[model samples]
Target chain A: AQSVTQPDIHITVSEGASLELRCNYSYGATPYLFWYVQSPGQGLQLLLKYFSGDTLVQGIKGFEAEFKRSQSSFNLRKPSVHWSDAAEYFCALNSGGGADGLTFGKGTHLIIQP
Target chain B: DTAVSQTPKYLVTQMGNDKSIKCEQNLGHDTMYWYKQDSKKFLKIMFSYNNKELIINETVPNRFSPKSPDKAHLNLHINSLELGDSAVYFCASSHRLDTQYFGPGTRLTVL
Candidate 1:
């Protein structure tokens, strides 16, 4: 079965520091990858997605993700993290179309230090 | 303007009682889905409807039923709620084979 894994359960970083959240997926074919961020008591917002072209995809809120096919990984990165960046991040995978449901990771909690 | 929205942001009910959560999307998408996020923040897809037809049901209990009156609306009804059923339920909509848009989510608590 297709699945997503986020190895780091919690990550603490200082403000203005660089950030990287790891995500790895298992699927038969080249998978459609997505990264979503959820703030406290808020719905998930799409940070970035990787489909076909360009291994590097940029998303809203100054976030970027690189899709590595051989490694079966899509890691989210952000430079100069802000205190408001403290939130939970989830990595999800889809098999291609809307017909298939997305397989989500357990999520990683990001803590921004002052 | 909310692209996808769910009613009753917070619901507290008894174990044996029944409750309903409504969802609507203004994006004119053909597909809608329900996902449950547990206390550990692990999200899993529960049900999906396409064009007002049930397309996917992921091992969900019979007590949980999803109804889609139209392409833009999907509702989830639970009969005999259980303590284990307490979780955050999110509603999402997407155009055919496109990125999905998620709602604010409804937190259901069974007492």
Candidate 2:
């Protein structure tokens, strides 16, 4: 079974500062990876996904993630985070089909400090 | 228009009561899924339907049943709900083996 691990439970970053959220996965083969964001009371919004071809996948809201095969990691990064970027971020992984669905991490709570 | 939507954004009920949460997707996708988010915000897949067929069913309690009327709608019904059943249920849709789009979620609170 494929599982995702997001080590950081909560991270606080000052506004306009660069941010990086670490995510690692355990899978037998090459996997599909994704990053999702959730607001205070809303549903999840897909930040980005890595299907194939590109090692670096760009997602919505100026977010990007690099898929490292050796590291088994797909860490989300942003050069400068705004105040609006404060939310819960989840890292997910899927081996193949959507039937089994994607396994998500415990989620990382992002706090934007002024 | 909402791409993927679920009914009763919040559901509050007591133990032993029965409730149903409806989900509909207008994205013309071929698959739909149900996921549960616990109080601690840990998410797990409950069930999945593809083209009106059960494609995935997790080790959930028998009280939870998923009914797919068509490819565009999947409804989740819980029988004799318990306290442990309380959580936020999310509905998602996706193309065949593609990125799944999620709904706003239904916060089912059992008191």
Candidate 3:
């Protein structure tokens, strides 16, 4: 079975500090990776996705992620964190398309400090 | 504009009862999916429909059935709701291989 792991359950960073969220996936073939953000009382918004081609992909709201096949990881990063960035971040992967369904990580709760 | 939407954002029902949650997406996506978020915030896929055809059913109980009236709508009906069924249900839609847009989700509480 394909599985996603987000080692960090909770992470707190000061405003303007750098942020990184780790995601590791287990699959047999080249996987399609994605990152999503969810705000309080809201649906998840897609941040970025990596299907093929580029290993580093850019997403919305000053977010980016690097897909490292060598490490079987796709870690999300932001140069600087903002208070508004506090939310739950989830990493998902398409083990196989056409209804295989995305296997999602438990998610990481991002906290921003003043 | 609203991309995907689900009705009864909050639902509270008793055990052994039946309920249905409706979902509609205006994004013109051909694929629709239902996901569950548990109390611990763990997300899991329950079902998926493509072009009104059942494509994915992931270890879900037969008591839970999904109905797709058209390309834009998919409804979930639960029978004999149990306490374990209490969770946040999210509806999402996507094209053949594009990004999926999620709805605000319906919080179901079974007592």
DockQ of each: 0.75, 0.84, 0.78
Q: Write the per-residue lDDT of candidate 3 for residues B13-109, one digit (tens) a residue.
A: 9999999999999988999999999999899999999999999898989989999999999999999999999999999988876788899999999
Chain B TM-score, candidates in order = 0.99, 0.98, 0.98
Cα RMSD for predicted model 1 = 0.8
lDDT by residue (tens digit), candidate 1, A1-114: 898999999999999999999999999998889999999999999888888999999999999999999999999999989999999999999998556678999999999999
Candidate 2 stretches with Cα past 4 Å from truth are: none
| lDDT for model 2 | 0.94
**Cα lDDT of all candidates, in order?**
0.93, 0.94, 0.93
Query: Second chain of candidate 3: TM-score?
Result: 0.98
Better of 1 and 3 by TM-score: 1
In model 2, pairs of residues that clash are none
Identify the candidate with maximal DockQ: 2
Fnat across every predicted model, in order = 0.61, 0.88, 0.71
- True-vs-predicted CA distance for residue B43, candidate 1, Å: 0.3
